[model samples]
Target: MYMVLVRTRVLPGDLLHDSYTGIAPPNTYKLGNKLFSLKVGLVEIDGKDVKLIPLAGPYIPRVNDFVIGKIIDFDAFSWDVDINSIYTAHLPAQDVFGREFSSQTHSLTSQFKVGDMLAAKIIAFDRTKDPVLTVREHGLGKIVHGEPIKLSPSKIPRLIGKKGSMAKIIETKTKTKLIIGQNGIIVVQGPSEGIVLAARAIHLIEEKAHMPSLTNMINELLTKEV
Candidate 1:
């Protein structure tokens, strides 16, 4: 089935579609023969399947999910990280130093100081406790250089676009590299000119996520004279 695009931003209780158009997905309520949005998001009609794409929301961590986090604070055992979530995640010193970790012998400050940024994976998370992160895996570690920026967590999918098409477009046009975190943090590394353009393109995706022609709009901005 093909998809039909929508550009309208919606709020709670806004009319969505009719029952005959197929039932609206989650975050929507049915009123007699009509469906109304139950959250702040944008409407999408995929074939006969209508759903809402949220515009604003916090990142909810899941195990094995890669995230971009900033080192906020540190103790001898672990470091507190801001993963753009309500709960702060912790990266254990052991994860960095291996299982036989020594708080005294191995100084955490020497490895990762406060205000440092790192890309990590959510090794563990549950409602009972905050998430746990680890950077031992390949492609996960300290971000020594790059221009970091934030976007609405809900808009990350849009930023990446369908099957990473949008991200590829930005990278190809700007000659920049993007490291995206599911937590809404992005680090752009490349020429200063390319970084600036890439950043602008990212913000546009966040602002116009609800727009049907979002990809086209971003392309226009990326091609425009700086």
Candidate 2:
């Protein structure tokens, strides 16, 4: 029978498991009898499997990932958006307006022009093809106002904190509304001063995500700002 090993923290290139111990999962690869970590992350030993949870990495598009994008160009049926990824995302006109879209009569530019910002969902992506995006879902549409800030995609979870606790705290203390995209784009809306404060708080979170007592430190900083 297989046995579970104690949890351990590991860094990139660290030996995580051996062939006799467990099979590596995500962020780890096996070579010979040893499984090595591919990222700075936490390792979980579950029964006969070893899994790694990455703490840092660039944003990689995945299905259903909500993102904020800026319109860069448009063709007859689709618009290309910059979603802060290596691949540009395509938002089809039909996807934006549903199946009722009349391509023969409606002008795409009239509905969505260049430079428009939108909150969209990644519908599809692959290395061989450009990413696909859609704004048909609820609360996914044009972003008309607010200041946009960028942070490391890896730090998004930390900024959000556990169960949205840190995000709620930032919004409460700064009196702002935050719309965070998994791609590390955050739109801050509220009083101008509040927006600045919220942005500062988010930057602080991004800067110190790896440190211990981060949540408390952010809380204290917010208290001082408020």
Model 1: residues with Cα > 4 Å off, grouped in runs: 1-9, 14-36, 44-50
Error of 2 at 27 (Å): 1.9
lDDT of 1 by residue, 34-132 (tens): 878887987777566786877787888889988999999999899999999999999999999999999879999999999999999999999999999
lDDT of each: 0.88, 0.85
Count of clashing residue pairs in every prediction: 0, 0
List per-candidate RMSD values in Å. Answer: 3.7, 2.6
What root-mean-square deviation over C-alphas does model 1 reach? 3.7
In model 2, the clashing pairs are none
- Tens digits of per-residue lDDT for model 2 on 181-226? 9998999989999998988888887777767688898789889978
For model 2, state the Cα shift of residue 170 in Å: 0.5
